[model samples]
Target: LEPLAEAGVDAVVLGCTHYPLLRPVIETVGARMFPSGLTLADGAEATAAELATLLTERELRGAGPGGLEMLVTDLPDRFAEVASRFLGEDVEGLAVKQVDL
Candidate 1:
């Protein structure tokens, strides 16, 4: 990060789905390293938009609020708690489908 900052990188792509969770930490570190503000581009939103465009182009998009299906290799006790953070919604009633991997 320091090297990139020194190189004067103007923007950084939050490439991973998990990267947004660390945004606060990343912003703090970036503020210290980069005297000028650095732009954080969310790859997740871009990916979702691209997926939607492709689906629409192929006329494969469904109408109505689609149900969520989560497949996990193993279901943890705190799964709902953690998943809620990602989805930004209460998922207490959501069923967890565990699959054998």
Candidate 2:
């Protein structure tokens, strides 16, 4: 953050699955570090927003509740645990299929 501030970077992308959890602290530090204001963007939220916009524009919004299906090539046992952690939601009872390819 100090390096970015020194380099005059005015925007920071919260790019990982866990970075959003620290958004408040990051914003406070950014405000103090970057005197000229700063922009903090959550990458996942931005991507989801863009996807929603595209789906709406293309008239592809589904009429029913969306279903989530997780597929993995290996480690079926750990997939759910890892996915739940990464997604920040309880993915219990969700089928995680193991694929050969």
Top candidate (TM-score): 1
lDDT of 1 by residue, 1-42 (tens): 888898999799998667888888989999998888989999
**Residue 98, model 1: Cα distance from true site in angstroms:** 4.3
Error of 2 at 82 (Å): 7.7
lDDT of 2 at 31: 84
Off by over 4 Å in 1: 1-11, 73-75, 85-88, 98-101
Error of 2 at 55 (Å): 1.7
Q: Candidate 2 on 1-101: residue-level lDDT in tens?
A: 89999998988889976689778889889889998999988989989999999999999999899988877886877877876786788786788888998
The 0-to-1 C-alpha lDDT of every candidate, in the order given, reads 0.84, 0.86
